[model samples]
Target: MSIQTELTEQLNRYSVDFIRFVDVSALPEEQNKGFPYAILFGIALTPEYIQEITNQPDYIQQKIKREAIHRDEFHLKERKTDRLADELADFLTQKGFTAYSQSEENLAQTGSYNEAIQQTSLPHKTIAHLAGMGWMGKHDLLVTPEYGSAVSMCTVLTDAPLETVLYSPEESMCGECQVCVDVCVPGALKGKTWNIKTSRDEIVDIAHCTTCLRCLVMCPWTQRYAQRPVAVR
Candidate 1:
């Protein structure tokens, strides 16, 4: 079997639900730190838990908060992301390649305000999209066909000999829909549609985001129905 296929099997054993290898040669040499390829993996969220948001207002809010804990994978699962990344990195290294896994925790924290990327240790979502996993949602979160904005991602960058995919970043499907915009209690969402070039500030006010969970609850992908009632004028 090909190296990529073999690696997939190894990752699957670790509960990695999504896996993709991407070419990061075009990224700033420092961002990738000279790693030409990146391996991306994601853990899917439970759909049954996220579906609780469609209930009555009080029920929806309570369910969202309770489920958000699970959706974010607060305890064991949160640590699992890093653990799996390391395991994958080790697996790649054993194959005689220079591999390094990036911890999803504290992403950039680069201390640069002008650059959106400086906010995290690494843009795992960037790797996720480049890996053909999913696109960014209006909430500045990754949205996939299967899990919507409910999945968490981790990444590993390496100079491994495994194959790489041509970069075709996923496109946003938020379109003109404004459910996330309308329901945001903090009024953080600017209602702008996302694209490859869209930055967080261009659409949402990061400073104003209250983490209210409205956008998270209103997201159509997390619900059984993919559409929300258009906000009353």
Candidate 2:
């Protein structure tokens, strides 16, 4: 079997919903040096959990294990992604390959898109798109046909000569779907379709985003499982 296939099978032992690797050598030399291939993986969030989150206040008022908690549930999932990425990086290192990993909570925020347009030092979103995991959404979030933006991403960079897939970027699936834009409480989303060249400002105004994450819940794909009536046992 190819090394890529073996690695994919190994990582599948973890709770991964998606996984892919892509060449990122075309990017700036500063953030990326010898590590050209980015190992991207994502975990799908609980549709019911996301559906319950109507806004920040809703998230804040959530009860977990019979106790009220704020953002704890969300951060818990981010930690899971980080843990798996760390393990995977270590696994690669043990095999005599150099690897570095990053997660949402453990981001290399040299800066943010809110600051300079190109300030994001290590953008996992860009890596994920290039890896063919999904397309950039008009909502300024990675949108996958299978799970929409309801998945948390983890990234790792390595220089190992592993077999990688030939990628043709996933095309935007939100054609004329203004649900995310229309439901955006703060009007952060631009309702514009996304392409490889679409800039952050063209799709989203970060300043206007309240981080309520209402747009995530508004994604049509997110509601796929939620729309079904509960099966009474």
List the candidates' TM-scores in order. Answer: 0.77, 0.80
Worst 10 residues of 1 by lDDT: 105-114
lDDT of each: 0.71, 0.74
What lDDT tens digits, residue by residue, belong to model 1 across residues 1-233?
A: 77788888988888777788888888887578788988888776555434544343355445467875444432345578777878878887888888777864423332412354335434788888877777878888777777677666678888877687785677888877788888887788888778978877887888887665567656887663234343598
Candidate 2 lDDT over residue span 46-86, tens digit each: 76777777443346334553474435555566777778888
Which prediction has the highest TM-score against the true structure?
Answer: 2
Kindly give the number of clashing pairs for every candidate: 6, 0
lDDT of 2 at 133: 71
TM-score of 1: 0.77
Model 2 whole-model lDDT (C-alpha atoms):
0.74
Residue 126 of model 2: what lDDT? Answer: 82
User: TM-score of predicted model 2?
Assistant: 0.80
